[model samples]
Target: MNNSYFWLRCRCNEDIVLLKDPKSDNRSRGKAFIYPKERSYKTFEIKYSNKLSTKAKFILSSFNNKYIYYAIDDLLYLLKSNPTEKENLLTVLYSSILALHNNLEINFFDIWIDNIYINEIGKNNRFFKVEEQSQTLTHITLTLFYRTRSPFKKPEAQW
Candidate 1:
């Protein structure tokens, strides 16, 4: 079987990529696998809505035309050299995850440095205006490789 992935720009202007798992059928056989646990497995459904939540707004505005793809391994190197930048990237990632959980009741199972793409803005002199000082800013976009949702059930009573 051929395994490959590609990126495409969505209508929102953000890059959208689909990642496929080679061993998806045998997911339950391994313990070190990246897929979510069996108990959390739920069917994926989409609810068409024109409204955006406050959390979604904040997350979108955070990456609004501020950065472009820098490098694939930028996060790995940044962890050793720049602590502040690393923290900022992590905060955005976690905040996004939280927002998704709260807004859609969805959960991202795999989140790691490799899944994050780093983008650098204000790094080129040609893109800078005379009045605006150039400052390199790093932004992150996370790719969800695996996700799952649990069935809606009321809390069980403990006696």
Candidate 2:
């Protein structure tokens, strides 16, 4: 509940163009930002509200601007070079999932690939022992936002 976001200015052709920051500090000033694909803003906010909890919203807020593709490429390189550093990201995912099904007794469907989003939350160069098989530039942080659509269906099955 203590998260913030930036709203989209307008939908560019096949690209997300960030518009402005929320003008007010009101709790519900605007819809949470998302890396939407083939979906309307209303559909993502209303239809997928179930997964928009605090833990998940934190991740959604990370994609408040462009240049995310480049950051992701860097993140992937870091992970590939050092797989052991995946614990932090996995912990966030686990908490988000727990919050997703909090106080619920419903049939949870499998995660759809389209609904999952990952955004980089910048990076910090901290002290870490240089491992022989690891890259020295493993520092980009990340946030995870997994959307929930009703009757979730795997991409392969839709074909």
Candidate 3:
């Protein structure tokens, strides 16, 4: 499998750019690898029927709000302090991990932790589970499917 590179900024105002498995990078890749590609060891398959409502479970009025940022910071700290081997979670986790370890800050304002819908997606692309307590610190695991392919870029879509 060929790896690619991209950039992201963190809450601390640091820039992070690095090479990583192409499957997860969201910008400029121009291609999307369908699930079950390479991280099979980390993905989990959940039954299709057990679905959660799409209505917004929680919403923060603004990122600039003190309580919102604090809650976000706390969530990030919690996710990083305790690491998991699950690929998708680990993908986001390790991506954040590398950025911080390298002193690069991700633009946390652009990506809302509460907006991450890992549990909402079902069947195929749905890959992990997170068990939380009081919506704070928690446990997470990933289930990867075992099919590998290099998908070509579809026009107007960015992966």
TM-score of each: 0.36, 0.24, 0.17
**In candidate 1, what are the lDDT values of residues 15-67, reduced to their tens digit?**
67766655555555555444334332212222212233333334434442222
Kindly report which residue stretches of model 3 are placed more than 4 angstroms away from their true locations once superposed: 1-69, 72-98, 103-119, 124-159
lDDT of 1 at 129: 79
Model 1 scores what on Cα lDDT?
A: 0.44
Which candidate has the top score in TM-score? 1
Cα lDDT of model 2 by residue, 37-116, tens digit: 54221112112211223443344334344333433443345445334433344344344434445633212232221233
Ranking 1 against 2 by TM-score, winner: 1
User: Best candidate per lDDT, number?
Assistant: 1
Q: Of models 2 and 3, which has the larger lDDT? A: 2
Question: Predictions ranked by TM-score, top down?
Answer: 1, 2, 3
Tens digits of lDDT, candidate 3, 1-159? 334655566888688755565676678655532233232222222222222222212321222223223444544554453333122333443454344334433232322222222344323323444432113222222221223334467789565
Candidate 2, poorest ten consecutive residues by summed lDDT: 41-50
Stretches of candidate 1 off by over 4 Å are 1-30, 34-82, 107-114, 123-134, 152-159
- Steric clash pairs (candidate 1): none
